[model samples]
Target: MKFWQRLFTAFLQRFHLMRFFGRNRSFKELHQSSYAQEISKNLSKRLLNASRTQTNDLLKQFDTHLTGLTEEQAHTQQMTVGLNEVTHEKPLTWWQHLWYCYRNPFNILLSLLALIAFFTDDLTGSTIISVMVILSTLLRYWQEAKSNQAADALKAMVSNTATVLRHQVSAEDLELMHERYGIDTKNQTTHQFEIPIQYLVPGDVILLSAGDMIPADCRILSAKDLFVSQAAMTGESMPVEKFPLQKNLEETSALELDNIVFMGTNIVSGSAQAVVLSTGIQTYFGALAHQCYGY
Candidate 1:
């Protein structure tokens, strides 16, 4: 019986068995490798706040070296760049195509054979094979369409634009906090310096609430009746409580990060903003998706 089971399994794989079984025997990825694990693990790193002096120094460097903006007024202008564009497309490799071609090559070949056999009036083995070939073509096309739809949905999550603060006060300004926390040294004044959505990297904090897709991976800084669904990364069935990152970390017995959702997790119930810890393919879902697709 075991030998027959093995033989049947081989037969199904050889003839693109999953296609024949319809949805019964779908190809599922079981695991991911360490290389992919590393991509997900070191997803985000926070940049240390530059002191007012450091911000001034960095601003001067930016003006003199990168962009030639001499006026202090020019510094107030938004600085936005497409940092996450590199992870936009995952072009299929030649080997991936080769493997797919090998798996489904029979469909194309069968299509041709069916036409030939039909014309030649050769029904010996052609009848069943020809029907199988046509069915396989329909199945493959359907799968491709479904995959494209899922890809489009995933792209929609990150591609849509959102307002983000680009150059926030660097965390190093402790003394300045005693006086005026909002003063811009170069501007010689204080003003909200919100930049475009593109410049947002990991560790930048953003405010979020009901009906907002997370801009990046963030540990919950605070939550007001917060609830988040992490199905995109963890495949959890329901939304979990969103807790302050500090509280989540202190509970050593439980998964600290369990209640603390990452970037791309949807806020299901309440409202909160977290420090964006990861972005682009560095996101938990992004990294996991990368691994799953590679397999």
Candidate 2:
């Protein structure tokens, strides 16, 4: 990087990394926070760069096992990484939605008609029109509020989650995760559980089966004839088969490797347990989405 580029890079990492040190930032709230598309790829490039190793060694780097993170760790990573969803314009309140419905020319004309009726000494006619306008406004507001609520809920739940194994999480991080996300920290045993896509962090051992969405950028650990549909990201209608990588197998980029599974792709056949390395806007599909949608 040139001097200016280096300076700008330092400036960003300072602000971006600071949020993890502060209160948990809302991915829902922060659109540019990840800047996975702009501030240079943080998580994706690491795994891509590290793909020169065997899958086994790759798992070691993330401190993951076949089982998954205890609930605490998953939730903690959720806080750090933000939710896995597209950033949208701030949602409208009930009144705001109502106002939007009423702003049209028809609504304005109707309201004016009601006012004219009132001033013309037609009390019954004015009352009817006023009632109609008020009722319509209330109904419009109710419908819009419900629609927005449903859409918001859907957005929060849209990210396809993954199954992961927990292992070797630190005491401080575990405790912090427990305190922040209310996980079951009492039991010392670490096992597997379903983890949402957005909360995924490096080193999570993710289990995959046929028909499951690959939640993050991952290195294949174990595979049983695993085939994935990369149509959304790669635009290939055919499902591509994959396997665990061995040492000395070189690839210029992680995406070029057969042992890697990317986000937004679906497993078409068999199963696997891969170590998650990159998620959210850090996945291959995320990068594509960022470029196409500018989200």
Which 10-residue window in model 2 sums to the lowest lDDT? 24-33
Q: Residue 185's C-alpha lDDT in candidate 1?
A: 45
Model 2 spans with C-alpha error above 4 angstroms: 1-47, 65-79, 83-90, 112-131, 146-161, 168-190, 195-198, 246-256, 287-295
**What ranges in model 1 sit over 4 Å off?**
1-82, 85-159, 166-199, 248-255
Q: Whole-model lDDT, candidate 1?
A: 0.49
lDDT of 2 by residue, 1-295 (tens): 5999778767645433332234533332233344434423554456555565665566566555566555566566667877655453355566656666665677688788878988998888888877877788888888878887899899776655566666656667556655753455656455554445556776677789999988777878789989998776555679988888634465544444677787777899999988777667656666556544445
**TM-score for model 2?**
0.62
For model 1, how does the per-residue alpha-carbon lDDT over 1-295 read when each residue is reduced to its tens digit? Answer: 9999889878776544444554421112211345433542344222111111232353353343222222222223323423532253344454543445435666778867877887898886679887786566556656866787799889767444443333334344322422332323454233233333444554354666777777655555557999777665555678888665333323331112533465566778887645554455655555555554431
Per-residue error for 140 in candidate 1, Å, reads: 12
Q: Roughly what TM-score does model 1 have, to 2 decimal places?
A: 0.45
Model 2 whole-model lDDT (C-alpha atoms): 0.66
Global lDDT scores for all candidate models: 0.49, 0.66
